[model samples]
Target: MAQARCPLPSLLLVLVAVVLLVPRAAGYPWQVCGNTGSFTANSTYQANLALLAIALPKNISSSPDLFATTIVGAIPELVSALALCRGDANATTCSACLVTAFQDVQNVCSLDRSAAIYYDPCILYYSNDDSFLSSADNVASASTNRINLRNVTSDPARFNRLVGALVNATAEYAAYNSTRRYASGEADFDQEYPKVYSWAQCTPDLTPAQCRVCLAGIIAEMPRLFTDRVGGRVLGIRCSYRYEVFSFLNSPVMVQLAAESGNSGSPTPAMGPTSVTPSAAGGGEY
Candidate 1:
């Protein structure tokens, strides 16, 4: 018996459909889940999650801080969730980020009762418990690009110092001055290191003091964590900081922040050309 083979074009279309239908692997820079417990399928927890996942993103768009949270269902099956988009993200970008986040959280955490997913543009976290809202979790996590710096700078230590200064200043502004609890700016070292761009953010829910503590913790750990990497970010559930020689943020937003923070001298225009090679680093939680 001879079996008829499918046409090449038909086979190609079938393959494309299968690829599109497969749940994407986590695209987060880092993800962490709690070991507290797991929710049963077709249960109250899952149902509440279904609702919160849909509502939070929409709610965040109306807030000035681009942050939203919700508590759904009753005790024992309750799901508390939150989403925070990058401070510079517009409403459209924020919505899209959360949509992708909703899928990633479900795919990566699966049955975990508590989970946090960090993307370059947003952060999503959920749990059965409500403590996450007030706990001021200072736990820190880092994802560093393992690749060595491509163009070596003669005085690595000096360059590192300049980077630290830029990030530290931005962190301070984010914690104490920015109403949105976010700030970003650029530093130039007279073409020695070209342009160094940096951004820092803290969850708006935190008090200024708590935000400062969280930002300082991660900033202090950056040198040890990123080392010689050209670009990397240190993240905490409450705070995060990222920097590179290139710009990945909205220019107008960053310039406005710098002006308000009295750092208006920092360049707002794009400096030369730059590129970033997405890293395939794994997740870590502190």
Candidate 2:
């Protein structure tokens, strides 16, 4: 008996499946505050913003802090701009991320006097007001993982506790231990399932205590903000935290650190097809 083959329809279906499976690059999310304030073309504020956009990336790349803040012109027309790259990012990555952010901000928030762009590798914020320089604004913008935590454990509550401990410890290490104010590591809950890899970072200008506070605030919000998610992040002007079941850091050092800490288990082999993409779910202005 010969089996009849439906090759054409089957091929089309396979192609459709492949397209759906591929992950698209979402880049980052940004906010432009037109009602809060705005600037017109050819205005002094606009000119200052243009200059700040060009200078911020360069300053960040050259500085040891991997953070840069500048005020162009006087207070009224002054444009207070800052660029903070993720602590683990290399200078090249920081520069490119800032460059993309600069262009993206202009496109997304064109003519707005106040705006901020949040990328996975960096953040760019500029405004007519300088208050953000010293203030810690936790609610400005944020996102979380698109996928939920695979229910690998019998006790989801216990999983949450272990994740919290790893994230909190990473925050402390970022705040007090690293010169770059960043830390990444992993923790093993079940030897057979994926180990949770996490990282936290703060802008170096913040005092250790301040950095801890910023990290803590976001960490506390995770359960409410992205419950049941295997990986997610909460970003703020002063600090941010991220964790995942995969190698989000994309660095071997994270694994080494976990091993040194005696949690040598690696992320569980992909049990199924899961997409670890970030989602721009909820974000609002300060």
Candidate 3:
């Protein structure tokens, strides 16, 4: 029974209900706020920053960068946004997701100088300063894109073993692969099904070691038992990890390249201890 085929949920149907009813419950999962407090910055400086971020995704929109600048906001924090469609999604679907994330985040965050938002479909974020290209913010957050799981849950230990194998392999690939700091692929687990489909990505500036550390930190969250579905993620300023039964992007190739150019080493600020944790049981999953 656990091995039965599970269909993909209607992202649109569920997302609409989730946004109207339980959006705040998400607690801004992909957030990295510096309680140090956000201060206002120069407007001219922030606009330039936003441009760099929007340019990363070529297929999303030709004039999104221009549209983003038009959205009136305070504080000139540098801004840059990224939207990566799932490897299996078509261009139209990816574009739609980007539009939704962009609009919703604008409403959700309002006028924050430095903020980023990630989605299962894509991500969009900007700050009044260009601090992102060279470094990631310790003030970010993320969560799993929910999906249904099969029989693995019947044996908690076996299910965890599968998640472990997938996340670990992806973490290794992400930390070491300089040409592309992102990796998503399958691995066998419990010798059943594909067992795992894991993904790992780091801010372009982070060193491979840092990416590994971040990925490993999240992978530790796989518990022997299951609750909802077989999906979770750890989003940090420097890197993040995602895993599910399905591939999340529409890229034609198995191993893909991040198209953005330039690799300046930006320093992500230190993530000070927060009472925060990743598990519902409590604490950052790491």
lDDT for each residue of candidate 1 in 1-286, tens digit (9 for 90 to 100): 9999999999999999998786433344556656569988888788889898889888988887888888888898888877788877888888888888788778777877787777878888888877777777643321222223554354555555556666776666666666777877676654545677787788888887778777776666665665545666766566878888778887332411121122223222122122221112311110
Error of 3 at 215 (Å): 1.5
Better structure of 2 and 3 per TM-score: 2
Candidate 3 segments whose C-alpha is farther than 4 A from its true place:
1-100, 128-151, 189-194, 224-229, 247-286
Q: Pick out the ten consecutive residues of candidate 3 with the lowest summed lDDT.
A: 277-286
Off by over 4 Å in 2: 1-35, 137-154, 252-286
Task: Sort by lDDT, best first.
Answer: 1, 2, 3
Q: Which tens-of-lDDT digit does each residue in 106-196 have in candidate 2?
A: 8867887877778778877777778888886543532223334455344455556556667776777677766777777676666544578
TM per candidate comes to 0.74, 0.73, 0.53
What RMSD value applies to candidate 3? 15.1
Error of 3 at 192 (Å): 7.6
Q: What are the RMSDs of all candidates, in order?
A: 11.4, 11.9, 15.1
Query: What lDDT does candidate 2 reach at residue 57?
Result: 84
